[model samples]
Each structure stands twice: as structure tokens, then as C-alpha cells.
Target: MSTEHNDLTAANREAWDSKAKEYDAKPWQKKIASQVAEALNSHADWLGADWASASDQECHLLDYACGTGSVTRALSTHITHATGIDISSAMLSQYTSLLSSTHPSLVLKTSVADLCSPDPQPSISGPEFHNFDIAGVALGFHHFANPATCIANLASRLKKDGVLFIVDWLPNKIAPGEHIGHAHAHPDSHDHNHNHNHVKEEETEEWKKMKKTIKTNGFTEEDMRKIFEEAGFEEFGFVVLGEKFVLEMNGKKVEKTGFIAKGRKV
Candidate 1:
């Protein structure tokens, strides 16, 4: 790996380790749990709509960089089991604690290894990696050091006819703090009593640091399409799942216009 690439990966691990607690503690982050849950359901829906009904119940999922495992919790019912992998143990720890409480009987596994490793190259098959029917990368593309390798790894892990899902913020051309807005409507029971700008300064600082090291502002449509194609996936489909998330960080209301993208392995 290039020095810059290694630096970015290390920086992401450190940044996430430092901010894992605060990141998960944010009121918005907590609220996102259900929205992500809903998104997972939508992924299930999409699979049924685009593919067949028989494959629904037996599918296994891989939650790549599954920070806090909110999606894994939501996905408990739709698939046979799910495995979450991340580079930060702190993030996985938070995920485990929440997983045990929210879905006590969930069959979940976690690892603190880079799925996008380049040297030995992380394995994507066998008892260790498992054959994932659906693999989702939620809001994680920007943190990748080499997206081609990352997507390739993800694509390689899928069972035949399996799909890869990518959900993330739309790319932008400006600095932070411009897209401020009120939080979206979520269920009242999951709501919290917190201000939008509560962690503005800290997140903004993190954003600045991300601007320096993160791979991209976010992935564009063409960017993602090319990525999927380069990874040897076919029949790419993109779904606009609405703005399911928004957080005021560093005084900027970062609105999340998520996409439920899928690439089938033919």
C-alpha cells in the first residue's frame, strides 16, 4: 500500500476509536438505528422485488464496517445470520453491547480486521468469511482507503446471484456547515431530547480532518456505478430511499440522501 493509503487507514482507525462513543451517543445516531433498520427492510424488499422470493429467508448478510451494528440488529429477522467486520474494536464493542440488548437472540459475529486489506488480501470465502447473500456498506464508502479493492473484496464475498448494497451521502463540492436542517421524522418512541448542534465543533473538527485524509466527499452515482462494474458485478440498480438521516455536526446539518444500490454477481 502507498504511504498515503496506510496513513488514511490508520487515521480512520484512530479517529473512529476516539469518536466511537461520542459518535454513537449522538441523539441523531441513536435515531438512525430505526431508519437503518427500515433501510435493511428495504434492502430485503428490493431483493424480493428484483430477484425471487425463495432466496429471502436463507440469505446471510455481511455488514462491512458495521459501526455499532444497528443494521445487523435490524437485519436479524430477514436473514439466517449476519457478520459484522470493522477496523475499530471500539465501534465493534459498542455494536456488541447494543446487539445483546436490542436483539438478545441474534446470531452475530464480529472481527477487527480490514476487509479491504491489500498485502495478503483478506479472504472472502470459507468458514471464516462465509458466503454472504447480501453485503451492505452503509455510509462507509468515504472512509475507504482504496474503494476499488474494497468493493472488489465485497463483491468477491457474495454468493452467486447475491447482491452488494451501498448506502451513503451524496458527494458535494463545498465545505461543511452549509446543509443545516431539522431532524427528519422518526418514530416517537425512538426520539431523543437533544439539540442538533450539540456536537457541532467536535464533528466539524473531525470533518476537517476527514477532508484531509478521507477518500472522497462521498461517492457520486457514476463513481459508484464504475466501482460496481470494476468489481465485476452486473445488473446495477440504484434506489432512492429518501433522506433517512441528517445530523448537525460542526454546525453543518449534513443531510443524508441515501441510495439502496445493488449489484448482482452473475
Candidate 2:
């Protein structure tokens, strides 16, 4: 990876690690998580036919950039096993804790690894990580330094005809001086007790630091389609969720529309 990309990976790892403990503590975070999960479940067709009809033991999911296993939790009932990979160890710890506590019987595991790295570790590139029936990243695309490379890496892990999907924000126009933070931005950091015309001046420093970890505001349908095709995937499909998510960031309420895009490995 380039030095710039490595720096971004480190920054994001630190950002997510710092927030892992209380990631979904806010009501809005929980609500968004639940809604995204439901949307994924409701549109199983985008996940491919094998995912729709396969027996539990026959399907395996690779939850890439899987912060606390939101995608895994969403599709656990349908797949026999889920392997999660993320750069943040703390986030993986949260995933482990949640899986053990709520889904004890489910076969879900996580590792601190970054497949986006040009030279992935043996443990991450091994057979164990390959041939997944489906690979998905929920709300993570915008944080990636290179979305096309990320998609190619994830695509390499799937078997022929396997599916790869991403659930993230669709491109939205931001009005003048309006700031729309990433979906996972912490609500607690914002002072909600007071009304303000702009984001708090004190929060600007922190936001600046956090913004380093975000690579883009959002992706368009055409962008997703081109990347998926470049990654050697076919049967592409994209769906915008029916519900919009309202995220409170440093006292600013930013409404976002989320979309899911998928393609089959060929």
C-alpha cells in the first residue's frame, strides 16, 4: 500500500478503536443498525440465489470491515458461519463479546486484519478466508482509502458466483456550509442539550481528526457499477433503502439515504 493509504488505515483503526466501547450506545445508532439489518434481510435476492436457498451449514459469509459484526448479526440465521475482519482490535473485541453474549450458538469469529493491504498476511489470505458464499461490508465503504481496491480484495475472497455487497450512504448534495459526518460518528460527543446554528467550535478539532479517516462523502450508482465490473463481478444490483437515517453530529442533524449494492463473482 502507498504511505498515504497506510496512514489512513492507521487513523481509521485508531478512530474506531477509540469508539468501539460505546459504538451503538446511542438510541439513533441502535435504530440505524436495526434498520440496516432489516433492509439487508428483506432484500435477500441481492445477496444471490445460494444465499436465499442454501441450508444454514452450506453458506458462509465474510463480513469485511465488520465493525462489531453488524452484517454478521443480520445474516447469522441464514449462514452457518461468519468470519469478520477489521483493522481495529478493540472493535473485534466488541464483536467477540457481542457474539458470545447474544449468539453463543452461532459460529462467528473475528480477526484484526486488513485485506485492503497490498500484502495481506497469510492468515488473512489463506484458504479459510476464501470461497465465501457472500462477502459484505456494512457502512464501511466511505472510510476506505481506495474503494475499488477494497472491492477487488473482497471479490478475490469469494468463490465463483459468490456474492459481494456493500451497504452505505448514497451520494447526497450538501448545502452550503453543511457538514454531514459519517454514519458511525458518535452522538455522545455532540452536545445535544443546546441549540446552535453551526457545529460547536470546540468540536472542530476532533472533527478534523475524525475526518482524516473518511475518504469520501458517498458513492453514486454509476461509481459502484464500474468498480464492481472492474473487480470482475457480474449480475450487479443496487437498492436504496426505504427509510432514511438521521444522524446527529456535533449538534447538526444530517439526514442520509443508504443504499445496498451487490454483484456476483464470475
Candidate 3:
């Protein structure tokens, strides 16, 4: 890996490791987890025919960048086995704890692995990591230094006709001189706040440090489609959720519109 990419990976790992405990405790995070889980389950068709027809034991899932097992928990009832991998060991610990407590019957395992690396670890390159019926990353794409390479790496692990999906923020347009911030908002809540500059001046430093870990603010549908195609995937589908994810950053709420994109391995 280039020095720049290595630096990005290190920065993100450090940032997420430090915030893993707090991230797992956030109510908004839990709420968005439920929302994403519902969206994925309701739109199963988007995942492709392989996922729909596979028996529980045969339905293998790879939740890459799987922090706290959000995607795994979301599909716990549907699939019997899942493997989760993340760069942050702390995040993987949270995922392991949560999965054990809530879905003990489900066979979900997690490890600290960075598949996006130019040379993946030996354990990650084994047969067990390949031939997944479905692979997914939830709210973790923006942290990747090279999302296209990440997608292609994940795609190479899937069996033919396997599905790959991503749930992440849609591109947010910021006006000049406006700072990005999120406030508490939900689809059912009538009280809405659209302003993106409500964060207090004191929190700038914290937000700045956090922003350094993010490679991109968001992604557009066109961008997603092209990336998926270049990654050797077909049957592309994208859905923008009606609900907004309320994020707590530096004691301020940041509302973000989320979307789901999926494609089948060709």
C-alpha cells in the first residue's frame, strides 16, 4: 500500500477504536440499526435470487467492515451463519459481545482483518472467506480510502450470482461557508431540522479530527453504479431510504440521508 493509504487506514483504525464503546452506546445508532435492518429485510429482492432461495445453513454472509454486527444482527433470523471482519479490534469486540448476547443461536464470527489491503492476510485469503451468498457493508463505505478497490476486493470473495450490498449516506450538498452538522430527525417525527450548521463553535476541533478519518462525505447513485459495474457486478439496484440517520458528533446531532445499493456477482 502507498504511504497515503496506509496513513488513512491507520487513522481510521485509531479513530474507530477509540470511539467503539461510545458508538455502541448511542441511541441514535441503535435506532438507525433497526431502520437499516428493516430496509434490508423488506427489500430482500434487491439482494438477488441466491439469497432468497438458499436454505438457512447454506446462506453464508460476509459483513465487511462490520462494526458491532449491525448487518449481521439485522439478518440474524434469516441466515444461520455469518462472518464479520473489521480493521478495528475494539469494534470487533463490541460486535462479538452483542452477537453473543442477542443472537446466541446464530453462528456469527468476527475478526480483525482489512481485506482492502493490497496483500490481504493469509487467513482472509482462505476458502472460508470466499463463496459468500451475500456480502454487505453498512454505513462504513465513506471511511474507505479507495472504495472502488474495496468493492472489487469484496466482489472477488463472492460466489457467482452472490449479492453485495452497501448502506451509506447519500451525497449532501453543502453551501459555501456552511459547516456540516446533524440534528435529531426521523421519518415519523414531525419536528424536523434541516439546518447543517447548528454545531457549537467549541466542537469544531472534535469534528475536525473525526472528519480526517472520513475519505468521502457521501456518494451519489451514479457513482455507486459505476463502481459496482467496474467491480464486475451486475443487476444493480439503489434505494434511498425515507428515514434519516441521526448521528451524534461532538455533543451535536447530525442528520444524514441514507441509501442502499446492491449488485450481483456476474
Cα RMSD to native, each candidate?
Answer: 7.1, 4.3, 4.8
Would you list the clashing residue pairs of candidate 3?
Answer: 182-253, 182-254, 182-255, 183-253, 183-254, 183-255
Which numbered prediction scores highest in TM-score against the true structure?
2
lDDT of 2 by residue, 1-266 (tens): 79878888989998899989888888889999998889988888556647534433478889988888888889877777788899999998999899879888667767777877767666675688789889999988888877888899898889898999999876566433233454333332223354456464456655666767876677778888999999999999998888887776655566778899999999
Q: Which candidate is the best by lDDT?
A: 2
Q: Estimate each model's TM-score.
A: 0.78, 0.87, 0.86
State the lDDT at 39 in candidate 3.
90
Clashing pairs in 1: 177-252, 200-250
Better of 1 and 2 by TM-score: 2
lDDT of each: 0.68, 0.79, 0.78
Q: Which stretches of candidate 2 lie over 4 Å from their true place?
A: 52-57, 174-206
Better of 2 and 3 by TM-score: 2
Model 1: weakest 10-residue lDDT segment is: 180-189
Per residue, candidate 1 scores C-alpha lDDT tens digits across 1-266 of: 78767787888888788777776677877777677778768667665423323655455778998888866776777666678888889998988877778777556777777766765544333565756778888877766778778888887777778888887765444334222111211111122334555453233566555454455655556777888998888888777667547765545555656666778887
Ranking by TM-score: 2, 3, 1
The all-Cα superposition gives candidate 3 an RMSD in Å to the true structure of 4.8
